[model samples]
Structures are given as structure tokens and as C-alpha cells.
Target: MEQNDHLGQARDVTEFPFGADFQSILSLIGDGVVSTDHTGRIILFNRAAEDIFGYTSDEVLGGSIDALVPTRFHDRHREDVDRFCSSNAPLRRFMGEGREVLGRRKNGEELSIEATLSRQMIGGQHIVTVVIRDVSARKTAERHRQLVASEVAHRLRNTMTVVNSIVTLSARRAASVIEFKEAVLGRFEAISRTNDALVSGSSTDVSFRLLLESELAPYRDDDSKITLTGPDIALDGQGAVALALVLHELATNAAKYGALSTSAGRLNVDWKVPVDAPPLLDVTWQERNGPLVAPPTRRGFGSELIARSLGVHGGTAISSYAASGVGCSIRLPLTGAPPLPQ
Candidate 1:
């Protein structure tokens, strides 16, 4: 009786519809597994499929596979099913291999998915199995990477253009090879320092005080020699870059012929924002206790650079020659600064 009972149990296991362990294996899979019969009715909906589609196996089994497809893709899904039924393609093929496909959950939320389809003839009936993995996170990450790449490219082009202008302008004004080399190297160093500060902080704006200190740090002997008085002001990227060039030119001139060249000299920078309509920043630069100053015979690259530094931003710079030293006044529109003329 025991042998007969064992034989009957084995026969029951063999006659099971899903084979001895097919359903058990499907339950352990991480990716969703779904199979449909020739009539497009879902036949096998595994545990993973239930989780992915937000449906229970009992709710999806024996229903049309269209239940899991988004409305926009229903017609295409049916065409693909018809092709599989007719064996128009290979027996097994991957879907959405290089691109994301759409899937609709039970709650009508659309999601990105990657799927693989396998066609088989089981007991003279056409069966199609699909293995699906959600790829919404991966798609989002890819788009983010593309945007960063495009932004980097734009910034690099702008930087290279500025460098080219510096090289060409420096060469035009240089008196000799040595002068050209010195001018180009000094300007490059100033730009590099500004870039360093810009990247050190998470914000795109740079402090006006920071830009001044970077250019004047080498010449400053003590607090008495160099004075900077102004409220904290932030400059946008283009503003920072333009102001850096202007500051470098002024510091270079002072070091060669003006206040910074003398030990007893003093340099003062003061700026104020008055209650004027549409806010303006008024900055004054004064020098004292240096050799008697006189205007240049003709305006040079330094003067031209200072005048145009705020380029198309509606700012102005003016210089005055005093018996004591050199003085400059600059006015910059703090609000409603316009874009550069294209």
C-alpha cells in the first residue's frame, strides 16, 4: 500500500500543468515574468510580475495582456504579438534593448521598462514569455549626464574665446617678445585665480572683495598700505571675469609706475550703493604719497581694457591725473544689467 501511494503521488506531480518546478522557479526571479497564450490572454503571471504591474496573479491571469500596456502602445503591442504568432522574427528577441519602452501599472502610472520576449510552441499552442525590468531610474540618470556634458561644452567654448581675445590683444600692445610673454602670463594667472575661487564655492557668484584681494595680495604690505571699504557684493560669472581683467590691469600699472611702486605710498578703494532709482554701485580708487602723476601721452591697452571691461553692461570708468597720484571712478549698474550685444 505504501508503494502504491508513492506511485500515485509521483503521477500527480508529473501531470501538473506547470511542470514539476516551473512555477517555483518563476517565483524566485527578480525580473517580472509574464506569459500569454496564442489568443493574447495572460496565462502565467509570476510574483515579480504581480509586484511590477501592481496587480495580483489572480487579477491578471486569464486576462488580455493589453491590461499591462499603456494606451498609446496598445496598437503596437498587438501588432508585435501578431508577428510573433506568425513567426515573422526570431524565436527569441530582446525588446527595448537600447531604448526605454513604456509600461502601465494597475494604477495607470506609466513607467519605463526593458523587456525580452521568447516565443515557444508548447503542446501545439503558441506561448510568448516576456521578462521585464523597470529602467526609469537609469533613464533619468542618462538624461542628467547628457545635460552636464552639454553645459561643460558651452563653458569650455566661452573660456577658449576669452583666452584667444587676451592673446591677440596682449600681442598687439606688447613692445617686445618679453613684454608680450609677461602680459599674457600675468593675465592668465589672474583668470586662473578667479576660476579657482569660482569652483571652490558651490555658488556661481563670486565676492567682489575676494577678486580684489586676489589681484592686490602680492603688492599689499599691510592694512595701512591698502584699504578696501565696501559692502559685500556678489558678481555673476561674466561680471567676475570682466572685473578680474580690469583689476589686473590697474594693479599692474600701479606696481610699475603708481602708488604700489613706492614703500610710503597708499592705495584706497571705496564703493557705495546709494538709494538711487534702479541701484548703481559707485567705486572710487585713490592713490597718495607717490611720485607726481601725469596723464599718459596716449591711451594704451590698459586704459582701453578698463573702459570696456563692463562691455555692454552699461558701466563706465574714468581716470584723472593728480599731482599726488592717479585716481579713477567707476559706475556699475547693480540692477537690470543687460546682456552683451550679440
Candidate 2:
């Protein structure tokens, strides 16, 4: 994810810097230093090389340079080494051009690395020194960031499509322009609130209970009569957003004609996960103690959304206007495909 070529020259390992120790200086440098002969045999191995390649000096001192390179790149690595050794450049050649190199460790695991080669002609033998730094962690992190960016872009497009559908459906049910605008704005507000919660959450999956509570927050006094029960599991990103819209529609209808319209009304919402082989989420919405319930003569946008959204989410949604109250159940299969952004 990052590369740099700094200006500096390291002295020969055998040279004494103002009578200071020679090998001690090489051991103190942070980067791995490996010295190889013209035949591609490693003649010098520093402590950093051992730490990076997982080999002791005794094991790798005279080993082929290909020992550090992956098996697939062995041919190319040897050819490059030979070409560098035969080059008619200056006596000291400093190369710091960045490359995505890999090193093979003792355990056979490969890691990303950045290496700089220095070719020097000492006496009559040509020696090559390579400096290496491990970069696997940085690369992995960069890949994750890219994936997050791509996922965010796809989800934003999906959200806009859902918004367009909501606008069209809301317009169909309104008699006047003012009524149409109010219906659209209300649905948009519900969607906006869900998006806010999604941004505030630390993970992509949202807590089911928290989502429901936020949608039902408009009538805080109804909390005393409303009940919610089950293990609070999380929903995937699309599932969370779609369910928020579904719950908002149900609550709006309830305030107009169902349980929430009367003072004595009560509502019970619960969920169950069966002991079957592949357990699924079974959520129920029931209301009672309100005005007499009647089935809708015509399907509205609210009804269509509640009835069809779960099906798109790899699940089912069904409702009944029984003599006592209105009841609905949504079944979401956990092992199946995740909810689509429909």
C-alpha cells in the first residue's frame, strides 16, 4: 500500500565506522539485508532477513536465493538476478524502484513485501544486496477499504431505486397534490431515520429490536401497551432498511384505523425461531381492543409493501383480519439468500 525510496547509502558490512563494530550496525538496521553472489547463492543473511523469512543464518547462509522467492516465480527471479549481475552499470548500483514482491517463509506461507536491490562489485566478484520489508498487513487493510467503498456505492443505488418506487406508489393513493406530497414526505422521513441509524451503527448488520423501537418512537406513550419479545438478532443491511419501511407503514395504518386509534387498544409483536433443522425468523404483529377490523376492499401501497417486501427478502408475509383484530406474520429464512434491495 505504500512505497518510498529514501536517499542514503549503507557502508560495507566489513567497514569500521570510526572504529565502531561492523556486524553490529547491520544487525541494528530495521530492514532485511541479504547479500548474494553472482551464482544467486545467499552469502550473507542478517537478523531482519531471518525474522522476515523465518530461517536461521545457519539454514539459509549458503542456500539459493530462490528459497525466499515463491515457487512460481523461481524462473523469473533467477533470470532477473543474472541480468542485474551482468549489467555494465556503475560499480555501485542503487535500485529502489517499488515492486509487489513476495517472500516464502519456513511454514510455506507467502507474504507481501517490498524490496530494494543494490549491486556492488567488490574486488572481482559481483555481490547483490537486497533490502526487504513486510507489507502484507497494509495490503490486506487497503483491500478491505476498497470493498467497503464498492459495497457502499451499490447500496446507495439500491436505496434510490426504493425511494423512486415509494414516490410512485404514494402518488397513486392520494386524491390531491398536497396529500400526495405529505404521503411522500412521510415515507421519505421514515427512510431517512433508518439511514441515520445505519450510519450510526458500528457494523453492517442492524439490531432488530433497536430498529423497531426507533420506528415506533413517534408514539412513546404506546410503549406501555405495546409488547415485543424474542431473541434480538441482527439483520443484514437491506433487510434492516426494508423492515423499517414495512414497520412504518403498519404503524401508520394502525394509527388511522387499528389498535393505536383507540385508547383501550393493545398490540403484541413477537418473534420465534423454531427448533427445526434450519431455523428461521418468524415475526408476528397482532392488534386488539380497538374498533371492529375489516379486510381492505382494495390494496394500497402500504398493504402491497407489507405483503411483498418479505417475499423479496427470501421470506413470506401474510396477514388476516380476524374477528378479534388484525394479525400478520413474516417468515425470514436465515440460511437462504440474503434480502435483496427491492
Candidate 3:
């Protein structure tokens, strides 16, 4: 009798501490924790499990764990429980173990959940413990990040379109060895600037007034030769780059053979965005008081650059050789700027 009494005391001491440890560990978990018997009946539901599934522990303790599973999974879940009970196979019980599943809330709203399940023997019976966490917010954030990355990539491609045009046209216009070298060098420099801007992941749209001033800076030595007037508007990276190259090519030509070739010439640039046109931006470049004006007998680099830039957006340009001066009018559809690197 004494030996049996001592053995009983030892068992009680071991079991009591073990139960306390198990409860302590379960209480610390943030996710829902549930234990089911070999017959798939719930035996334990932690406080977090009650909060997560919107069921009181008393209501779930003697019920089937299937109450938390979606109706669509009921049949397969029974098969799985049977297999697990028979084989006592080790089931994964961590974040990456189970296929993504939906858990139904008490309010009938469905939530995306990740589950980890494990099996153990308790009181001579096999039981399954499941830990579940809601992953909806994490999934949402991942999708949002992917969408932003895709948009940025699309914008960068659009910006490249303008860069490609500038390089092609500028290289084609080089007649003299020196002229060709300068054009190639200028194209490279422009591409470098574009790459620098893209690295920041900023939206590619830039203030139009700022772009114009920056592009026209090369001609600032004779600041009196050029005049600019316009309200500040933003252009997408592609539009800004295209317009900048067009202006650069025009300025280069004028300095070599057009208005800027002589002291008596001046260039005027102006823009207007009318509300009736919604998003359309209208701009004009006018050359005045230059030497005798005449259209090039053959289409040159300046002509090609302007035509291609406008052509991409179904735009139109009219170059006129009036008695007073040469005037070029370009009309482009002002669609919201294409995605491109800032």
C-alpha cells in the first residue's frame, strides 16, 4: 500500500506540472490553438482560439473542430482525420505546412488563414492540435507592392521610348565629323540623366517649366536670344524627355544654321492648357528676326525628331516659312503621362 501511495503521488506531481506547463505555453500563443480527439471531437480550445473563431471555449470543447473549417472542406477533412488517426503520421505544424485555407467567422465572413497541425498522444488517445493565423493583411501588402513595382517598370519602358528616338535622330543628323561626335556625346549625357532620375523610384512626371529651363540652359550664354512663357505643368517622364530632346535638337540647329546663327535672331516659346481640352497641353516654338527663312530641301534631323516625337501620340506639327520668320506648331494629345522613372 505504501509503495502504491508513493507511485500515485509521483504521478500526480508529474501530471500536474505538465498540465500547467502546457496551459502556460498555449496561453502565450497569439494564434488560435485547438486540440481534437482521435474521433475528431474538440477537447481543448485556448482563449485565443475562442477570440479568433468567435466561439466560447465551452461551446467548442465537446464539439467537432469542423465548426471552424469551411463547409467545402468537410468531406476531405474527414478523410484526412481518418488517415491521421490510423497512421499516426507526423503532420507539419508551422506556417509553411498546410495549403492556404479559409476559415469562416461567426459573422459568416470568410478569412484567409494559414494553419499548422501536429499530432500527439494524450491520456492514451491520439489528438491533433492546430494553430491558425489570419494572413489577409500580409497577402494584401504583398499584392500592393507587386502592383507598384509593375507600374514603375511600365513607366521606365515608356521613358526608354523617348530616349531611343533622341539617340537615333541625333546620330542620323551628324553631317561633319565634329557634329557627329557632339551629337553622340549629347545623347549619352541625356541617357545618363534619365538613369539617375529613374534610380529614385519617384513618379516620372516632372514640372514642364522646370524641364524647359533645364533643357534651355546650354543656350544661356546668350540669354537674350530665347524667351519662355508658360504656367507650370507636369509631364510624364516620356513626354518630358521627348520634349527636351526636341528642344535640344532645335536649339542645336538654330545655333548652327538657323536663328541663333546671327545676332539679329530670337526664339519664343509659349504654352497653354485649356480646360475645354481637359488634359491637352499645347506649345509653340517661334523663330523671329533670323536670316532669310527657308524650309530644308531635304528632311533633316530636326524635322525627323519633331515628327517622331509627335507621331507616337498621334500628334501633328506644321512648319511654316513665313515672310517674317519660321514657325513650328505642334499639337499633341495630352493623355496622362505614361509611367516612367522619375
Leading candidate by lDDT: 1
| Model 3 misplaced stretches (Cα beyond 4 Å) | 1-24, 27-90, 93-115, 120-173, 221-227, 258-266, 289-292, 337-342
For candidate 1, the 10 contiguous residues with the lowest summed lDDT are 6-15
lDDT of 1 by residue, 103-176 (tens): 99999998888898998866556778899998888988989888767755765676677788888888999999
| Alpha-carbon shift of residue 132 in model 1 (angstroms) | 2.6
Against the hidden reference, what TM-scores do the models get? 0.67, 0.83, 0.64
Q: Residue 15, candidate 1: how far off, in angstroms?
A: 12
CA lDDT of each prediction against the hidden true structure: 0.80, 0.75, 0.70
The 10-residue segment with the lowest total lDDT in model 3: 6-15
Report the CA-based lDDT of candidate 3 relative to the real structure: 0.70
Clashing pairs in 3: 155-339, 155-340
lDDT of 3 by residue, 22-41 (tens): 77787788988887767676
Superposition error at 337 for model 3 (Å): 4.9
Question: Which candidate number maximizes TM-score?
Answer: 2
Arranged by TM-score with the best first, the candidates are 2, 1, 3
Itemize residue pairs with steric clashes in candidate 2.
none
